[model samples]
Target: MDPVTCAGLRFAYGASPVVCEVDLTVRESEMFALLGTNGAGKTTVMELVLGHRRPSGGTVRLFGRDPFRDRRRLASEVGVVLQDSGCALDLTVAETIRLWLRLYRRGEVARAAAGLLADVDLEHRAALRVRQLSGGERRRLDLAVALCGRPRLLLLDEPTSGLDPQARERTWDLLRDRRREGTTIVFTTHYLEEAEQTADRIAIMDRGRVALTGPVDLAASFRRIIEERIG
Candidate 1:
């Protein structure tokens, strides 16, 4: 079964529709990227997939189940890193990771926490509280928490936004590892090069609609589509 499917998906904020008739399908273990200019409803689509918001029209399905209705049952199989860090501010970095590990019922909390921190290069900041960490550090912590369950479906929103080049590359390598492990990843990124280099397929959204969906080889075509739509 496809990991994600959305048909004629629609949503709005107080009557101003943000996602209109968006249709998408992500094959299992595929690295899919969503690209768009600001206010193009990329994040809104992610929210619907994650079941954080109900679509006003159309349908969203994950593994052949309703995401919003089956959200709790599906939680264990999915990992998510949104733009916001939802970690408790008072918790230390290591403490936060350990907490998620326990919630996910992972064995050997100490070892798991150490490994997760290392994945995001947060080992050095293990003792720092969430509120004490810089924005980049916090984002890394969020990623670690998301990976706690060894999820099959990973959703990332602007995952590398605040990182330096080296850190960003590390994040990419980590994601590549996940893909190799048969994890299906869907992400939204403004960096077209990231999509070109990492994604197998991509969908470009414009004015709340998906203007194009094609293989990464279609990067040039994507540019032309956007130009024709917006110009």
Candidate 2:
């Protein structure tokens, strides 16, 4: 079964519906990108998949099990990095990673903490407090924390948003390595080029519905489709 599967998924906040009849499937080791404009319900989909919000209609499954009902067990297999996550400002980068490791407890977190920081180019800031880091540096720190458990499914929201060119490229390379290691990744990004360069399959959402879904080879066409939808 696909790690993530949603069929006819629907949701609403009171009188207004946000997601309407969305169907998507993310295969194992696939780098799936969800692209959309502001208020297009992309973030809502992420919340649903992570079981942070319940679906009002249809179904969402992770590894063939209902995500909401099986969330406890699924936690071990899923890693998520949201756009803005709260971390103790006083905690150093290394301290934060070690603390996250305590949650999963799969193995030696101390040994892996250094590597995680290095992977995101935060090794130089390992001893620096979280509050002392720049916006781009904090984003990288969030990534490092999400990767602590080597989860099978990774969900990232605007992961490289504030990063510089070199940092962005490094983040891209890290994703490539994760994909090679059989990690299924799902991400939402406003940057079309990031999606075009990394995603195997891309889904573009507009006004709570999927406007375009296709292979990256056809990304040029998808770009036009997104523009038309926005216009």
Compute each candidate's TM-score over C-alphas. Answer: 0.96, 0.96
Which 10-residue window in model 1 sums to the lowest lDDT?
Answer: 222-231
- Candidate 2 lDDT, 75-172, residue by residue in tens: 88998898776788999988999999887794777778878888898889989999999999999998888888779999998888899999999998
Q: RMSD for each model, in Å, please?
A: 1.5, 1.2
Which ranges of candidate 1 are over 4 A from the true structure?
226-231
lDDT of each: 0.91, 0.89
lDDT of 1 by residue, 1-231 (tens): 999999999999998999999999999999999988889899999999999999999999999889999999899999999878889999999999999999999999999999999999999999999999988788788889999999999999888888888888888899999999999999998777788889999998989999889899886566666556544
- What 10-residue stretch in candidate 2 is worst by lDDT? 222-231
What TM-score does model 2 achieve against the real structure? 0.96
